[model samples]
Target chain A: MLELDRVGVALGPKAIFNDLSLTIGPGESVCLVGPSGAGKTTLLRLAAGLLAPTSGEVTNGFRETSVVFQEPRLLPWRRVTDNIALGLKARGIGRRHRRARARELAAAVGLAESLDCFPHQLSGGMCQRVALARALAVGAELLLLDEPFSALDVGLRSDAQQLMQQLVQERALAMMLVTHDLIEALRLGHRVLVLAGSPAALVYELPVTTPFNERTPAWLHEAAARLLRQPLVQASFQPLVDREAA
Target chain B: MAAWVRRLLRGIGSLTGVLLLVTLWEWGSIRYGSFMLPGPRDTLTAMGRLAEQQALLAAMWATSWRAITGFALAALAGMALGLLAGLSRTLGRVLEPVATVLLGIPPIAWIVLAILWFGSGSLASIYTVAATTLPIAFAGAQMGARTLDARLAELATAYRLPLAQRLWDLYLPHVVSYVFPALITALAVAWKVTVMAELLATDTGIGAGLALARVNLDTAAAMAWVVLVVVLLLVAEHGVLRPLQRRMEPWRTGH
Candidate 1:
């Protein structure tokens, strides 16, 4: 479990997120959905321990944590296999074992043939998969993903979402994902947190009763319609709409 | 374009450039008599004569040693200091101006100081080459270090990669890309500075042989020595540097 205990974040006197308390349980996936500049990335960074909160505490109960940034962050010099093996290499795993584990993850992420190839040779979606493989290679207890599938096309995105959801359930992994796409959040997360205000505050929490695997397109549509009915959900977009209108 | 076709075109273009240069040299030699400027034929004969004398090999080895030694030393020092400077803002600000000042000074200016410090021999020639080439290597290393993506640094931190692994896997690869190209340029500068220093400061090396040829008004011998140096430069650039550079290009592994 990862806990953000009434966390407050400020950058140069301006508050970004304030008194935000959230917990991702041992077998739970929580998604944060909000507009741009709502500090979604900053929140991810805070959870990953890349940034410290201004006030309150972030308690990490997991043995290991991994982050998937918006970018692939693959080493250009390293081949796909080596990139996937990065965490394993850091852990002092022997070359043979590291190679074995990396190959497994590469296949897990549908990049079996690209094991020998460089990151530059892979497509954007493939590179993201390599990043995913890297995270999985570490055996992270809590995985923090910031728009991991935003760069992919709709077909690829759904495929990737399916893979991620399947892995989460199979491994009983805990995840904290931030995305602007409500449907994606609804599909992957056990619970979705909606952030609103100029500097974001957790305005609403929607517990996704439907399991990720069983949720159909019809259910997703009905759920989205139900979410749109919430005044706060509509209000979250108001600021962004007003800014664009101006 | 196909790799083989591209390579063949580049080879043809290079040969054409060399022929054009030789043609221009021949024209210049004809305009001025062989006494003043030797033709390719006269220069070739003079080179053959020197080879027969067995002096050409010794002179070539002596000058080459000085150039390589000085270049190697400069590369090590410049890269070390450049990493320190590039990683720290305060160090970069302090050292960047010093490098710029060193670069602005003429290579000729360094030879006089080098001779005074090391006295006339390989030391002076080597020192002069190092002094002249240091700024180039330093600049290359600094820029290479600067090209590092901050996002990668964050990634490394998140993953908890060991310091040695970070340096080996991330930092060195990017630095080598910048450093190797600069080293190629530095190699050219090293040879030029070594020869220039040897002409004035030393009684041995190819430069000294050129001095001898000059005093005796043997224009063909001087041109032959010049040709030898140019050929060596071409070998180092095309045979060594270009091949190494191609291998270092990380994206080449993509296909």
Candidate 2:
């Protein structure tokens, strides 16, 4: 289990998040959805241990934590296979074994043919897939994704989401995905949390039962739109809506 | 056929331009009737005489060795110092100003000081060349180090790449891009400054040969020596520098 208890973060006198708490049990997928600058990214960063909260603690049961940022962040100088092998190499795995593992993961992600290609050669979707493969290869029980598929076109985005669903199911991984797109949240997340207001607070929590792999894109989009029209979510948008009405 | 002919015409035009300049030079020399303005024919004759006496070849070899050795030393030392400075802010702050000052000083000033310390020989010339070239290498390496992608470094940190792998795969590749241009510029400066230093503080090398020609009032031979230096620079640029630069730009292979 991964838990964040009363997490508070202040950046240079500006509170981005305060008293924020969430938990993910084994094999559960959670997504945080909110407006831009909602501290969704910050919460994910905290979970990954890439950032520390000003108040409150994050508890992790696993030895490894893997994060996939919005950008692929692949090393430009390294080939795709080598990039996937990065975590293995870091853990002091033998070169031959790491290479084999990287090759296997690359194939699993449909990137086997691009093993020798550099990051610059890959398309945005391809690069994200590589990033996904890299995170999976790290064997982290908890995966933190910060808008990992925000750059992809619609078709590729659904394909990547499907791949992620399969991987999460197979590995029994706990994940916290941060996204501004409600459809993405509805598709990939078992539960969705909303972050809102100044200093950032978790305003809403909703359970989503639609199996990520079984849901059609249309179904996900409809559910997502309906959630956006909810009293709480619409009320959060009241200021802008009122100004437009006037 | 049209493309080939156009290329041929462009080449011929360049050659004709050079020929026209030479023709003007020869005509002026013949009209002036002065040794100072010796014609191309007279310079070439002087070159032949020097070659026949074997002095030209010996001088060329002496100058070349001093410049090459000095450049090699400067490249090695400068790159090491640059890496040190780049990796540490304190080291950069302490050494960078000193390097800037040393670089600002003229080669002639270095030659005079070198002569006082090492006496009038190739040692003085070598020291002068190395002094002039060191800053160029250091600045290039420093820029390379500073400009390396921070994201890549963060990735390296996240992955926890081993020391050896980080140095070879990350640092060295970035360094190589800076090293090539630095090496070329430093080598060129080393060659020119070595000759100038040799002219002032040495008794052997092309600079000394030029001095001997000047003493004898043989303007033709002096001009011939100047021509020889230009030719050597061209040869080195094509034979050494260009090949190395091409080899370093492997990423441009397909593009």
Candidate 3:
């Protein structure tokens, strides 16, 4: 379980979050949706323990945690297998054991043939897959991803989403994914949280009980449309556009 | 064209340039006379004569030894200090200007000081070479260490990389890329500076051989020594440094 209890984060003099609280239990998938610069990435960083909240408490009960960033962030010099094995290496695992585990994860993520290829040789989608495999390699109980599939094209996005969904189910991993795409939120999250305004706080939360395999594309789109029709969801996104126009 | 054939063509093209230089040298020799400017053949003959005396191999060996030892010292010390300075702001401020001052000082000035301090021996020559090349290596290594990608650092932090793994997998590879080019530059400087220091302060190596030729007024012998130095530098650069760089940066080369 991961918990951010009434967290407040301030960067220098400016506050990015005030009184924001969220939790992810074992095997739960939560999606955070907001406009750009609404502190979605900041919230993920806080959860990953990469950032400390200015006030309140963060307690992570998971043995291991991993993050996949907006960019793949694969080390350019390391081959795909080595990059995927990074988290395992951090745990002081033996070379042969870690490499075997990396190979298995690479095959699982559809990168079996690209194990020897460097990050520079892999496509954007392939690089994301490598990042995903790296996050899984540590046997992390909690995975925090910040817009991991945003850079992929539509076809690749859906493919990556399916991969993420399958992996999360297989491992019974707790996940918190941040993205701006409503349909993506509807498709992946067991619960969706919408963030709004300066010093952003959660504006709305909705729990989707549909099984992963049962959520068809048309159903996802219709569900997303229904969520977007809510006054709070519209208001949550309005401030950024109004500011842009101003 | 096939890759090997293309490489062969490139070799031939470079050979043509060398032939052109030789032709120009021969023309200059004829116009100015062999006493003033030895022809390529005369220099070659002088080289053969030195080889017969066994002096040529010994001189080449001494010069290579001094240059390589000095370069090794400079590389180890400079890389260690540069990495330290790069990692800490206070240390960087203290060391960066000192490096700049060292770089500003001329190699001849260093050689003279080294000879005074070490009393005209191998120590003098080695010290001069190391001092002249250390700043260059330090600057390269410092830049490399300073420019480590912050994103990767974040990734390492998130993964909770152990200190040893962080240094080996993250810091060293990035630093080597910058340091390798600096080391190559320092190496080229090492050869020239060693020869200069030897000519002034030592009685061995290629520089001393050039001095001997000067005293005897043997233009061909002097030219031969110059030729040997050039050959050694080319062998060090193209034959050694380039191959090492290629091996280390295979990803950068798309290989």
Local accuracy of candidate 3 as per-residue lDDT tens digits, A1-246: 999999999989999989888889999999999889899999999999999899999999999899999999998888998999998988989999999999999999999999999999999999999999999999989999999999999999999999989998888999999999999998899999998888898999999999999999999999998898899998887877698999
Instruction: Record all residue pairs in model 1 with backbone atoms less than 3 Å apart, i.e. clashing.
Output: none
Model 3 over residues B1-255: C-alpha lDDT tens digits? 899999999999999999999999999999999999999999999999999999999999999999999999999999989988888879999999999999999999998899788899899989988998999889888999899999999999999999998998998899999999999999999999988988988788999999999999999999999999999999999999999899988778766
lDDT of 2 by residue, B1-255 (tens): 698999999999999998998999999998987575999999999999999999999999999999999998899899988888887889989989989998999998999999999999989999999999999889888877777777676566655678887787678878878877888888889888988998899888999999899899999999899899988987898898878776655443422
On DockQ, the candidate that comes out on top is 3
- Highest-TM-score candidate: 3
- Clashing pairs for model 3 are none
TM of each candidate vs. truth: 0.95, 0.83, 0.96
Q: Which scores greater on TM-score, model 1 or model 3?
A: 3
Model 1 chain A worst lDDT window (10 residues): A194-203
lDDT of 2 at A34: 84
Q: What digit string (tens of lDDT, one per residue) describes model 2 on residues A4-115?
A: 9999999998999788888898889998988777788888878877677899999988667788888999866678888898888778889899899999999999998998
Against the true structure, candidate 2 reaches a TM-score of 0.83
DockQ of every candidate: 0.72, 0.35, 0.75
Off by over 4 Å in 2: A235-246, B1-52, B89-94, B216-249, B252-255
